[model samples]
Target: MAAKPVILQNKACTATYTTRGGALVDFRLQPGGINPLQFRHREKSKGSKEVFFNGHFVCLGNWGDPSAGEATRGHVKHGDFNRLQWLSSQKERQALLSAYSTLEGLYMERNVALDENAAVLQVTETVQNLHTVGRLYNLVQHPTIAAPFLDGETIVDCNATKGFDYAFPQFSENICKTWPCANAFDGETINLSSPDRAYSSVFSFLVNPADEWGWVTAYSPAQQTLLGYVWRRSDYPWISHWLHFEGELIRYRGLEFGTTGLHKPINEIWGKGLVSLLGESTCRFIDTGDTHHRSYLSFLHPLPKGFQGVKQVEVKDNVLVLTEKNTDHTIKISHQFKTKYAIQQ
Candidate 1:
């Protein structure tokens, strides 16, 4: 009983969203262009419930795994949001999708709208606690990029400041570094801004506390296109970058951002007191009958030849501007959307 995919279109872009788990299956610029978020094509992992981890799915209720006690209660590995079916309705270029997590007694409603004149998708998710008691939760936007949009020539740029490696064996978890430079498991330093098959790792970085918005961009010089996302820094303070490699080729890259950076079971996260490490909150608690809202914007932009990378992204007065790295060149898009935490005037 898998759900069918819904196509939402605009003059500049086309987006396909599947009701099953509410995963975004495809997002490509109009007129037959490359989709950078085609992770389903290279996905090889599935949960015990037979749900495939594909496309750009949200990791709600939890991020990685469930606690031992929760597992014994038949809890799925990454929570029920991605495994359960969601109800959806569409109106023109906007769609509303809703899903419930029976295990956690949480209800989620999402609204996705594509801009009429720009290649930008605006998403807002509202989570409400239905239980009698307060509950802790995690919500992560898992947008994975795969080939042929992802290759050695694709460059990833972000505004992350400090970060720590998750699975590095040689380096202590306390050891920290800035963005794009991480200590590999073999104790070697690896650059993350570009694709490199030298190391496959997962690293989480803290967004600059001073900035109101956090953004990540992937630019492919070969296709002369760029895909990027911007969200409220107050809502998603951490961004986790996962580099999955197979054999001698890079497979998928995860540009995940959420409330939690420690991708472990609940008990471990609390026992180790990794909640406030690096001054970033790992989990959020929702009081009974209370609701929380989070929103973000994802857009596609055409790049000029010899474009080095992204220098900065700015959103103001319902307009988005992107600056090219090491140059004064800029691209601007006009929209009617506003982020929860707009840049301070």
Candidate 2:
């Protein structure tokens, strides 16, 4: 027999999978703990939580590598990847274990399996809390994309007019030019060519506080294809942008989206009221206890000649709309209650 269908294991990795959802193809071990090599944990720890696309490092936490000479800037940390800290409490550990067991397969197979013939690899993960107490915290999905796939030739075109410009302060004196569009504020979108440009990241996508959702695309000009697509939903409103192209570290770019603004702590931005509590309380807090779902679908498209234009896409009332002039594509990905949780006091 093919070695009981128990969770797959190897010397450097151990992971579970979901036959119903083709999720988590791999969960490799790192020095700290298990990093979801497929789809990393979203918070602030960077790749400490997950790595994707064989080389696409999905840093589920905040900030790039601290030792990579970029620590002068600020990076926030949420409770998502603090497994050692959770080990202190039995209840907390059990709750985390339960959540892990439910989504283990996603980390093992879906993240590690590379189907050379396939252009897109999509994985979905859901975590539900059966406990009665509320859960307070911040969650984010970080994916560190490689430089070869997103180098100087890459271009990002968001249908929206406004975005957060990260190359400010450093280049304000010499490279201050009005943004191309009406909504391109001075704080949105930055070019990497400017001097004094320490680093460039975009964090200005306003999401729905009730159910925030957005997508990030990584395309390879040489290959004339989209490397990946990361779509997420949450109750938080702020999104963070991180771009890295210097130092001895891997030359990769990252566009992280989340519920709160970059550089602001979750507790401070959401306030003590919004924090997910373990117990029931009437205090002011924003509870995103409901099921939050995110998925990444990789697709390969043929390179068209000068195919640069704005593509209008949105998910409204559960319907995904993709419009480009008269050519439009629509897909429906609705779940009844795939993942559920509650925020207690």
Candidate 3:
């Protein structure tokens, strides 16, 4: 039998994490509000099959399709963490879960803690290589949002810079394009910040090298609510925008940020050697017995009447300040993270 899901609650929010894949199955504002992270249970039949992409699950070891040899060997897409069970325990408003990836020889531990006075969740993940040899790995936070909260009017905001379409034959900087303006599969340019566009594609953008922080937000005008995430730029330098629609209607949107943006295999990313153009390593390296840590926060803010989308998000004195677009209004939320990986002042 599978273990029970862990529930963490505070005065401002309630979060539920399932041990099945250590996925954040549900997160909602206090007093019964609509949960925006409702994306769950979709069958993925490619490579090793039987895997499902669910709500807010971490893509460990890798991001996309494995090499042909790796796939033939029964390797799953986006790593085995999402397809395997995890050990979990919770105390009060915090939950701790751990899972080991046999294929990657890496052990990952995650700590999910909720703020007592705000609808904020701080997630810290640490991975240690248990193998005897050094290896390259990628970790992506895949927080997908779906309907009831996601629609044609939803607006996405971020600080991403130059980016490229994933359909490109190779990951090259020569084809890099500015953010919010990307080439659709139909050979037309469209603004990627809105879900109303008539295209289904993926785009990746690099963070400004000088910026210490990176953030991505999605606001639902009709719902009068917004969901956002913030992380250290040094930790997660790339954000991938995935838009899926059906017959002029939006279906799902993925606000993914992580160590790697390229969705190819290890051989394709490292063997191709495009670090000079990326200005950063496309894959992270970990030696035996060494551990790597990353931290990020997801929060929900109640939007006021006549409020616009997010124009800017900043971390100011342990608080998350969001400024509205085309307006001077700003919303502040408590964002004090109790972890060593917290962003420094």
Candidate 4:
């Protein structure tokens, strides 16, 4: 094969990959528009990519769009972009470029995979310190699914209690929350049918400590298919949930996985666990630093007619355990069934 862009499609779905950034620019299910995905840039000059599934938007980002700003901006304050100075110069750009190139190469090597039955699509990426110095970087997975699947007919069920209450002033209180627990499933999943009329776009769910392996799932009421994501925890520590209910933009829900809380300081949080680079010394660009890998699996399951039951999904023990080490290493696993389901049609 000529190593062309990878494109996976079947009777039910389609996904497009680009080697430039090893990004999923296009993903869609048949009979599209259920979730219309769009990518936007804070600076108009910055470029972006919009991914759609079933006509609904799933993910969006620069995806090798050179126009997108090379620097990752932090939380804005008082209409100022001060916190974004982390990567403001040529030196920082060069460092980021080196790290990003490594990630891009991984994406090229292990970008997309389809299950044997063709019922799932898997995306994988690995990050290795290519230079002699260590580097700090930010990574996030932005996946959006249709909200009608949950709000209209289906419901979201997870093993969580009270929802994380967001106290931040900049974001919408109803959209985001601060989770006390480090793991998912401890945070409550948003119930679209709540009578309190309190609906949140951003919330956290508790993942089984055993499954500390990361993942997100979406089930369809009409199709009786469950779309699940099983990800590696070493690369992504946190997962973010987003829903678009009242906007004209698009009717959808998002399950974003990442290294830190969205719109929050992840490096600080991960640094406490010694997983993320903390200070300037740890951010040096050296090949002698550590390497990490994150994998995500997406698959579909056919639900029996009238199937409606909640089941406790457990994480694979071997998959979630992490060994503490002062040096870098590699972690790999073949994880399955990380996504639970309550099929109702």
Candidate 5:
């Protein structure tokens, strides 16, 4: 039988999570509508996506592909959290899932909760090292957005001030640029919000993190809905903005936040110390039996009519306030997750 999912619902939204990989499969906003989070390649492709790549998955100990040298050290792309069937249970409006990945040498416990009357779901995941020797690691929250919700007119915003593109030896040279607007391969500066078939670029925002929090937002003008995320800048000070639009059935964008300066393997990130994440190394050094933790909040808000995009977002007194870019319209979200807390499982 397929691994069953635990359902968490409220008056405004419902979330479904599968035990396989403990992946969040669906997060529907309001009553009856499609989920903003897209599934991977359900639209008839030539090749198969063997690993379950849907919705959002926690990347523990690593994020992207590991270097050849690092691969010899037992590194896998996106870590090993998505390869295990997590054990799950629930209480009231919250669900708890736990699992241990021998490949990643870590045990993780996660807790997900939905607000009683708002389209907000909060998740907290903690990964503890189970190794006999110290290892280099990193953590990232990978949330991919796709069509029906992400369109040409959709606007992406964040607190990033200045950044540059990645200059891989195989790819083109990267240039330093500002946020939201950067030069694409076609030699024309394009807004990150707009989609282009010829655009193939990765913008790494050197996040000028807030004193306590950092944020990213996406507004679908066509859908009149806004998605927002807030997290600690100290824990994850780098944000990667990946945009691709090559084919109809294979295009998607990612608003990835993590503890690394770039989406590279520990080989490129460690001792060389090419970049620093909030005054620390991009690669983390975890001793045996030690634990690492972080917390974040994601909300799907039904916006007022004519809402173009967001100007500012901040947490105040257990409330999330979103200020409109060109108007006085502001959305406030009040919930337990407005304030950070440790994960309980």
Candidate 6:
């Protein structure tokens, strides 16, 4: 059976989710406007093979490819979560989706709630071990942002100490820990926040040891709007910067936040002293009937013109604060829920 799409909305936004893999296909502002998220980066596929190029999807079980010819062992690229089906239901401003992946021996459930007349999306998710033995898993939220919302004048603001190129060994093996500063393969100092500094595409991490919480904000001065995400570091210790660009033909960045820091499979990441890049390790040993929970929140707020960048963003006393990086401009928003991560290890 074809997995039907589920829609949830409030006054400020509308979200669409697919029962297959529980991917959020669309999230846009109301009453009607373009999706803040980009989609269909390429033409249709010619076969049954799937592409991770969708607007937004979740990666699980395995962050990357499985071991060679291990399909019989339920190994699939990025996990079967995106390849499996989920059961869904909704009530008013909230929606619930749940599924069981026999391949991964895990059951996952997600609840999304949109507050009335608010521009916030609260997401809560739980993962349970259904198998008698333990298993290693990787989970990431892949939200790629692109045009009419992305431009060279756009700015990325976040607090991270060091950065490492994910795939380019020439750069990864040598880049400095000065953060957002990297020596390209050609000895050029590239600014990680610049959308135009891409070199053959790369995967990188915003390495941090924050146990309280973490956040990253993207400001589109062109649209006079800002988008951001807040999560707990104990649940997700790393934020990944995915850069890909080739002139006007393609340019998109994945402000990815998730469990594992390394984008490789379990074998490459498990017990390999890869924690520096693997972000806190999504590798967990769960016996039968054990459950784990992780949650995060996303928001889209309008910004004033000429807002170049942000210097600080913190959820203090349930108030979201944004202090401009180079000026005296500041924006504060009061909300109901705290930005703190609910479940702490």
The TM-score values for the models, in the order shown, are 0.93, 0.47, 0.94, 0.53, 0.88, 0.87
Deviation of model 3 at 315, angstroms: 0.9
Candidate 6 per-residue lDDT, tens place, 90-124, comes to 98878999988887888989988876766777788
lDDT of 1 by residue, 201-303 (tens): 7888988888888999998888788999999898899988988888767888999888888777767777777667677788888899998988899999887
The deviation in Å at residue 333 for candidate 4 is 18
Residue pairs with clashing backbones, model 1: none
List all candidate RMSDs to the true structure. Answer: 2.7, 11.6, 2.2, 12.6, 3.8, 3.1
How many residue pairs clash (N, CA or C atoms closer than 3 angstroms) in each of the candidate models, in the order given? Answer: 0, 55, 0, 31, 0, 2
Candidate 2 local lDDT, 1-345, one digit each (tens): 221212443332334433321223333332222222233333434334432222232223222232222222322233222231111111210111112212111111122222223322334433333334434333344444544345555544332222345333221213323222221234433442221233434434443333434455444454454433435444334344455546534255544444333343433334534232212111122233344343444323334434442254455443344433234443233322212233222
Task: Give every collision pair in model 6.
Answer: 261-278, 262-278
* Tens digit of per-residue lDDT, candidate 5, span 105-176: 788998788877777777777878897887888887877777787777678888775565554432222454
Q: Could you tell me the lDDT of residue 123 within candidate 6?
A: 89
How does residue 177 of candidate 5 score in lDDT? 62
Q: Which runs in model 3 stand beyond 4 Å of their true positions?
A: 338-345
**Candidates 3 and 6: which is better by TM-score?**
3
Residue range with the least summed lDDT across 10 consecutive positions in model 1: 41-50
lDDT of 3: 0.82
- List runs of model 4 lying over 4 Å from the truth: 1-5, 9-14, 18-109, 130-133, 147-151, 157-200, 247-250, 265-289, 314-345
Q: Model 2 compared with the native: what TM-score?
A: 0.47
Q: What ranges in model 2 sit over 4 Å off?
A: 1-118, 129-133, 159-198, 207-213, 228-239, 247-250, 270-298, 314-345
* Error of model 4, residue 166, in angstroms: 4.4
lDDT of 5 at 61: 69
| Model 5 lowest lDDT segment of ten | 41-50
